[model samples]
Target chain A: MSIRDTLKDIVDNVEGALAAMIMAYDGIPIDEITVPQSGFDLQSLSVEYATVLKEIKRAAELVKAGAMEEVSITTNQTRVALRVLNEDLFTVLIMTRDGNFGKGRYLLRLKGYDLARELA
Target chain B: MSIRDTLKDIVDNVEGALAAMIMAYDGIPIDEITVPQSGFDLQSLSVEYATVLKEIKRAAELVKAGAMEEVSITTNQTRVALRVLNEDLFTVLIMTRDGNFGKGRYLLRLKGYDLARELA
Candidate 1:
């Protein structure tokens, strides 16, 4: 399947998932999927979240904490999870406030490797 | 109680919690405590984790996501949870690999307000 298809598969498979995107380190999305009913701007959200991944990686490197593996943010409205796919890419998943964080994180981590390999 | 005592209280009350700190946004720990057996560096870890919080906050602002409520990063070895206490400060908690993430997060969120109030 293509990158966009893969991203769509993730959103479709995970309940409560509103959007998914494969983005570069520079805050650019290679492909993305958003549930229209969710009313979220995937493009802007991806760009904003990319800044988060970049900064965390930078901080981890500076402190010798090794590479950042995964980051999950829980807000009152939604849950955002990020997993570093490789040096230049990462994936973002936005889920509903009641979404299953553990499941969302697990699925993302499991699929991240495959996604990276496919894109490579 | 004092900030140090407050931090220590968090570590003591939360099951599997290894360490806790109240730190500035610049990565300086105002008060912190680590379980002697945990052998984790609160100073460096706090500093490193501070970078994660700062970066996330910046990214959130850029994306118009409003103030970051909480951030959680889970690695094979530990789980780090961060909550913004104020404009210039935040809190960090470190737990074991098998730590209770849901509980840890809840406790941090609950105590964050009280801690912030006391510090203020």
Candidate 2:
């Protein structure tokens, strides 16, 4: 099984999501499986989300630390979560409004850190 | 010397700041600060800012990791940079638009990591 598949399975098992997708930092879509469209502005959101991770990566370069582990955005309509997969890859998760966000966030963050070691 | 004073001096010493203040994570003003208001909101800005950190801290716990190192917000009018000084303390550098943001972000992020050692 691919890494992305593993992640999607874990998150989808939660039973309250409308849809979930893995988005790349460069606005590319990767490993997406959703029942129906969440109607999010993915392109704009990805760009804005990418900008933050790009800056964080730049900051990490300046600090000689490494790449970012995760980045997320929460809005009134919905919340988009990102986990940096590697220097060149990050994943964006889109969820329906009013889902179990706290649990989902915790799982992604913990998984993202472990993923960072592979990406590093 | 107090840590807050030191942070305030570093940002204020810049040639063209309208104002600079170090804000705590809980929307509390931690250090002495000043200036004619840039006319941008601080309280609302701070609360929104704090919410992000609170979430990040909670994620770190689930990850069994340390606290956040830094966070920042870039707006059309201005930028608010937060560096996690310790679990209880963080520094908010509010700088006017058109200043040297890249340089300032690098400095605060670098210093904030160093300060974490002192904090731990």
TM-scores for all candidates: the values are: 0.85, 0.45
| Top candidate by TM-score | 1
Interface RMSD of each: 2.3, 13.0
The 10-residue segment with the lowest total lDDT in model 1 chain B: B58-67
Error of 1 at B3 (Å): 3.7
The parts of candidate 2 lying over 4 Å away from their true place are A1-120, B2-4, B15-18, B60-66, B109-120
TM-score of 1: 0.85
- Summarize candidate 2's per-residue lDDT along A1-120 as a digit string, tens digits: 455665666467654454455556676765565545555444455555565556545543443333345444443344445666664777656554466765666666666665556445
* Model 2 chain A worst lDDT run, 10 consecutive residues: A59-68
Ten residues in sequence with the least summed lDDT for candidate 1 chain A: A58-67
